[model samples]
Target: GAGVSQTPSNKVTEKGKYVELRCDPISGHTALYWYRQSLGQGPEFLIYFQGTGAADDSGLPNDRFFAVRPEGSVSTLKIQRTERGDSAVYLCASSRGGFGHEQFFGPGTRLTVL
Candidate 1:
């Protein structure tokens, strides 16, 4: 009964470098979400996956950012040609697989692009 987990609690990379952030949701949770949080802003929703496919990804900043949940459990956020502005805390959360369900959040991955 482990909660959500994110790898590489912290990451530092040069600008324009590609990086991947991983997330493992709680067991049996079918709903997963990705969010980004800046210094003063609240966590901004990035994408949501229901099962093995992305159900909503309207918040993705651009094509440079992408995410996948191939088996409906673990997910990876891929950032390509990263920019300094991409620095932020990337959070992952999961729920019982529906709207209004309480979501469990991970500690998040702090990404710093120099």
Candidate 2:
């Protein structure tokens, strides 16, 4: 894709279910990130991948959330045992360099847990 694109624009799942959100970053972007946004708040970083390896994932809330960028261009965020509190918008962004670079964000995938 030319710009960042995320699949399954909206997802509604029951509590304890598993969900996978996909993000396709712009080609040749060296940095990819996954963030979650709750109501009335800014996006919170979940993971940051420099190329194919995760450089920093300190912001992830718990073991239930994981993100991977195996081939570097595309990434997926997997959430296990989803809860009602986990309902939020999962956002994906890409940048050109390691850190402090301008990022292009995709339209987030809205996850709703019931």
Candidate 3:
């Protein structure tokens, strides 16, 4: 029963670079979600996956961001052409399935675009 986990606890990159953040959800979790949190702001949903398919990716800011969950468990968030504006805490969470259940969150990967 591993809890959600995110890598790099902190990341520093230049204005135009690429980064891939990884997430490992709890075992048996069928739902995974990615969210970004700006300083002092609440988490903004980026993408959500149910089983192996991405159920909702509407919250993705732009083409620079993408995610995948092929095995219905672990997931990765990739950001292309990183920018200072893209700097934020990338949070990963998982639940039983739907919205009603509580989501367990990781410590988050803090992305800093210099």
Clashes found in each candidate (C-alpha, N, C closer than 3 A)? 0, 0, 0
Q: Give the TM-score of candidate 1.
A: 0.98
**Top model number, TM-score:** 1
Please list the C-alpha lDDT of all candidates, in the order they appear: 0.97, 0.94, 0.94
lDDT for each residue of candidate 3 in 1-114, tens digit (9 for 90 to 100): 678999979999998999999999999889999999999999999999999999999999999999999889889999999999999999999999866888999999999999
Give the per-residue lDDT of model 1 (tens digit) for 21-114.
9999999999999999999999999999999999999999999999999999999999999999999999999999768999999999999999
lDDT of 2 by residue, 33-62 (tens): 999899999999999999999999999999
Please identify model 1 stretches exceeding 4 Å from their true place.
none
> Lowest summed lDDT over 10 consecutive residues: which window, candidate 1?
95-104
For candidate 3, give the lDDT: 0.94
**Superposition error at 34 for model 1 (Å):** 0.2
- Runs of candidate 2 with Cα error greater than 4 angstroms are none
Predicted structure 3, TM vs. truth: 0.96
lDDT of 2 at 98: 57
Candidate 2, after superposition: displacement of residue 90 in Å?
A: 0.6
